[model samples]
Target: MAGHTSKRTVGALPDTTAESPFVPVALTWLAWVLFAASVAALAVRVLFGGDWAIPGVVAVDGLTVLMWVVVTFFSGIVHSYSRRYVAGTAHETRFFVLVFGFTVTVMGLVAADHLALFGLLWLSMGLLMAKLIGLARGWRQARAAARVARRHFAASSGLLAVALAALWWETGATTVSGIAAAADTPGGSVWLVAAGALVLAAMIQSALIPFHTWLLSSMTAPTPASALMHAGFVNAGGILLTRFAPVVTVDSALMLAVVAVGGASAIGGKLLKSVRTDIKAKLGCSTVGQMGFMIMQVGLGFFGAAITHLILHGFYKAYQFLSSGERVEHTAPDGGTGATIGRVASVGGVVVTLLTGLAGGALFAVLTGKGLRVDSGLLLTFFVAFTTLHAARDAVQQTSLPAAARYAAVPVAFLPAIVVYAVVYEGVSALLTVEPVSTELTVLHVVIAAVFVGIYVGIETGVHENSRRLYVALLNAGQPSSDTVMTATEEYNEY
Candidate 1:
């Protein structure tokens, strides 16, 4: 009788039949209006090919308008989803307000020209997101998670502040545009300091590698907030780098360092995700990797590609986070990840899969003129080819498929996806019209490529799984702090 009563009590906590708060509805409508305005801005840019700016205050360029569209669209979706998602919950009002604030703040951030305004918006974005992370005010774990996130944001803000001040001091310019205008003049110590600060700031904001713990701890946030956080908030790092592309690209050494860090985070994030049993933890780890790729694109001097990547990633991650609860857990019939672990493919089959990836990369080069040169474009092409190779490997490794079917899967299904990606890349690059940033081919590139491929092969072939120490390390590294985890049923009372 006591057990039955406890079950009833637990089930009744949700109160899903209760009406949703009105705040989210208003925010949802407003968000759509903001999205529409962004669309208008895009149309204007397309027709005029001119940036709209107030000189030292705010600016509207291709990057700004594009981000506005992506940010507001994600905002609208999150708000709309929350109308029912958080219905009757104590956090409903506060959550909607913060979401709206974050959305508008990002819109302001993308347009901000003044260093002061940009920094303020950036700081505000972090603060508001931290609050959303701790939305379950009654839950101690939630509050602890929020604190963890707040500290990370504070550190990121400080780094950005230092970068902005250094840039201003060096250039005697208080605006991002003015600083860009002064970029032709060499900045000595100040440039190095500013660029280093910018990279660190972006890294923390995007939650790459060592900075990713805050994000992992922030699973206490509501689903809609989680969606917005992953989709819109985190993408700010890429936006920051792209906005200051003129600054970051001026130094090859800095760009190379950024690429190396991005590469490490990319590989690290993937490995971390493999160790997580929780869905949100997995997604958080995945975000780190995605952000790594975005930063890598920025490091490559292809700011347009970085922007496109963030935009696409935002959409995909938003869907994943929001729809996460709908996931139905299942097991493979014969155990494992539903793939034959020891299946061997003929050498001819391996070549065909590899050739398909090469074809896709070749198509990308033709469409975007990226890989034709030995500069950073070669690495970009290699990444594309590598992705296609992974896709082909997945298809070929599926033991459920016949050998013939597996061999044909790459050209039939995956190649078109690469084509679409190339076309989009071309369109985005045209809009941004940024001169590609280049670094001379270096030994660093070769080493990075070799290490990345080796790790990937090891993981794909179950080499890493064989190492108990490696799995244990990743599992521990991916975990949130002890105080941030709910250990008791009462601690989960927030519902």
Candidate 2:
């Protein structure tokens, strides 16, 4: 049998000549209005250092303002892009409404001071997103994907409800700040259960491994919707943990569990991503990995670092999804001939990564006149090491430069990257007033980092001969069951 073909093109440029141009123009203007408000809110926070409150229900702090700025800025971009991308689609107006509603709910979620209000907005946002995912009315795959996402998200909502009820019952608090203040007074068992529930909710929302199928399936949605989902909504888990940091951080057991799940998801997602043939699916898997890293930062009690990672990853994923249509296939170098160079590059890259991280941490310490905290410094170092090494390996593989020049230049490139990362790390930490929780490194952190480095090196250096088998397994791991697709398709056809 021939493969099924989509009647609707995935990223085709829609004709605006026949359509009312006001739809996009109006949406774009609305997005910018929200963007301007976010900026004003941020400015007020920076200048006053006081929160703007809406009586007893909402409060806008630096974090809230910052996320507002982020969500609006990205949503504005996606809205404008969609002007041309989905201009003439049958559901263009409906698409705009869904996007606008989702954006507003997210902004509300960030600004919500009251826990009940936040929960309401959170559930609303999930519902809007599900509608957006299934917007491609007749597409069976799209409907199936939406069903998968809704099922997982509904489970997440239930967990969140339980957590919120527990928190409210224990602390007798209605607002986030109030809850945080009262959190310290709660007994150990109650706090532990609440924190555990929060972590599980985060895992489901962020699509951490085992709960990650929805993300992979969600690729059937349009690019703009996918972009917004990844960039704006997926980070809710990190935001949730950060917002409730005072409460969540008190439980060491919960923190360790977060780390364990995050570490597993990070490695697993990357493994799956490397093997995926579809570009959007690859991006989805990558989002899973990035969210894992973000959650890992939260687990390490580096809420500031987690926020930074969330923002950075959100922007990166948005850009990746928006530009996914322009992707071109590139053949990798012949492994036989490139193997030696790749191996050397991998080792050299690791050294450069370590040196860069050390230098960066030292500089940050010197400038701030504070000693480096072991956990935060190590977490930062792990990221810098892994990313820089991966980039170095890829660059060496692709470049035709002489071995001498390539080897010489790799280390030289590390100085600027390290300096920039160090500066940003310090800046964010100061701006957020994040203090290091521990001066000593834990065994778990060390083991996780080592395992990550080992896996990365094995992949980069072609040391693992069974990589092909592993990749195949990962690919199979991500595939939806045929029953799911067929059932959804049959149901849709009947309609």
Candidate 3:
């Protein structure tokens, strides 16, 4: 009996003879082709819009660009990373199959010109992502992560349905173009607000905070999912925002709603990340913060800036996930001795950050001059406080001299954006005397932009170990223990 048992156990050992069916090479190639097609479609829309409706042209152009750029880049990074990361895994081929299918659906979502089409694609992608989450191996934490992901999926789907229903009711048309037209028309406020609320659902799918719990949970998934989901599919929220930029402006309340959520999520994610321990969780939180930043930009009517931020962060996050290996180490790029900053950086980094922040704030306050209204002062103050803290946090976390040097660029880079905003807002204030542009308000915008730059520069130069710790906490925050997963599996007779 002992001999027989030994033989059975030996036979049950994982088969290492086969490679993962989901290697990303072929999938990457296919994604490239499809992405190119999307670009071509965009060019065609622009060159030949004579017969097309305005809404259709915009929808096609916007989605096409999103897929061609954001989706393609993300897919490529995930594919390359999977080659090294999952090389010997049996499901490699299966992984690629799912990734390819997911990518295709993503493209379809962006390419979708009709509301029903977009919703269907979104639902399909959500289901696939859930299944992918369930496929995570090795840790009991993975299974728990999958469950959380499913919950988020369900919520996202329900909200999307509500948005769709509202659209149908208001416009009597289900196409993207039709919905935009209806929302843009006079007396479309009710439906527009409802739709904007629904967009919040999409933002959840994109993993904005509160709804962002699932993204942290999903770290249990394979690294490939981490790269694609967090970096790639996560941008769907921004895409959706950009797609509806026109409609958002139609209703001031809707615009404010987007801004509120964006700002809240950005600040919340940043604070939470400071406490996380898991590497993936840290990156996941960063993604949320960045997405919030993008949303804020959209709210502020800077669609172009929002797009730029999205593209930069998407690729950067994807690279981090891909290059870090299974341990998800956040090492400095230079091959020198890198010290772990941990949470201590926050306390120590504050002094320098405050000085620089105040100086920058003062500059903006002067720029605002007499145009400073109460709201502008409030915004300006808020901007200065956040930027100062962010800079200090970054300075303390710097890993190498080069990284610290990069920190100096924040004020310089932001000057132009501040000047442009000052020029534009001041011009508006002059034209509409009821709300003259406050120097303080212009300073606020500059400060926000500056703070983000400071944060990213710090992140790029050196990483804090706290980022990893904070990530782990966020990832496993409310999940079951390894023992729990084992007990449940045994009870269910699952090996």
Candidate 4:
């Protein structure tokens, strides 16, 4: 009897092996088709130097082509990776279908030119995401996460509808290009109201601080789905702002509000990210921080920088989420030796970073033949400087060399990083059509930048020691517990 049972099990193994290759082959072909089409479209746009428009509804331009390349290429990679990731799953076919549908919807959203079409595609994408989140129906956590996401997305859809309708009514134009052209002549109170509505809608869609619960909870979904959500869908807010930059940039009050919300979310998200033990939840918090920084760029009138940030972050987050299964040793331990550098070294590091960054920026400007603009260029320089400072500080603390050698090595080790960033920034700026809006450095902008620097210094210098309780509270803010209610019902039945 035991030999007979073993023979039956051996016979069943071949059948499973036969079916394993089927789904992956189909998904791979689908991804290839999308990629091919995107390449063809981009070629036509570049060689022809004109947009392909479906008459007041959808248009394929340089921007659309760029996004299509990003979406299709990443989706293809994710699909191929997921084949092996979920190989033995019960509902593998269904997972493939959901991801493919989501990818198609995203492509459509990016290609949409009309406000109505864009709004419809946006809503559809949200619905598809909710379904994707609920893919693991047997898991209670998945169901709860899907329910919360659906509710938040439903609210976001409503706000988007209202904003689009207001823009359409005020401008008497349905196409994005038409509205942007009309926006040059600015309507009075109605335009302001529309801008405000759009800002609110973006805030909700991007999962800014108070509205960020759904995103953190959504870590229960499978890794592939989570990758698509973080890398693709969360970026819709930046797309909305960029698409309507001409209109949104006109309202100073609206811009200020965006800056305030984004700054708060960035700070709060970073603080929360520092305390997370779960890997996916930590990535989720990091996404919120990046989103906040992207939106803050928009508010500061650096449209080109925002777009570049969006594209780069999309690729990076996708890679992080997809490759998350591999185990890696932790380099930065709690209460580690590298946590803090002495005060004098910290100051010296900052000065070195600043000087190196400035030199790199000047070299970049000279090479590109594009003079520095105060808005985007200055902000990029500051970012490069701040990042270099962190690297320099860490290098100084971790090395076992003599003090003089360590100090000399700090700037040399970090110079390449800044130069690479500057080069990429210049290249992307060249490809983008929207120029940065010229704005003088206001006291408000300066003060905000200073506050950001201060926060970084305090965090690095252990100034939070005095407020350990507050830090702990922020750290524990979004972690799930037995008592936490993720949804109204104990078990969600949507699946």
Q: What is the TM-score of each candidate against the true structure?
A: 0.93, 0.87, 0.68, 0.85
Clashes of each: 0, 0, 25, 0
Better of 1 and 3 by lDDT: 1
| Cα RMSD for predicted model 4 | 5.7
What is candidate 4's CA lDDT for residue 113? 88
Per-residue lDDT over 1-495 for candidate 1, one digit per residue giving the tens place of the 0 to 100 score: 233434343344444334545566677789899989889888888888888889789988888888888888888888777877777777777888899998889889999999999999999999999999998888899999999999999999999999999998898999998888898885888898898898899999999988999999999999889999999888889888888878888888889888889999998988888778778888999999989989988887888788778888889999999989777465444554632133336885688678888998898888788889888988988888887877776677677877887787758888889888988777777777456686787889878889988987777677877778987998899999788998878768674
Which ranges of candidate 3 are over 4 A from the true structure? 1-25, 35-59, 137-141, 186-193, 326-495
**Whole-model Cα lDDT of every candidate shown, in order:** 0.85, 0.76, 0.61, 0.74
Candidate 2 local Cα displacement, residue 85, angstroms: 0.9
Give the local distance difference test score of model 4: 0.74
Task: Candidate 4: list runs displaced more than 4 Å.
Answer: 1-18, 21-24, 328-377, 391-420, 430-433, 480-495
Q: Pick the candidate with the highest lDDT.
A: 1
Of the two candidates 3 and 4, the one with more favorable lDDT, higher being better, is: 4
Model 3: how far residue 57 lies from native, Å: 12
lDDT by residue for model 3 (384-424), tens: 34555555555545666554463565445444545554454
Per-prediction RMSD in angstroms? 3.3, 4.5, 9.3, 5.7
Off by over 4 Å in 1: 1-20, 330-349, 398-403
lDDT of 2: 0.76
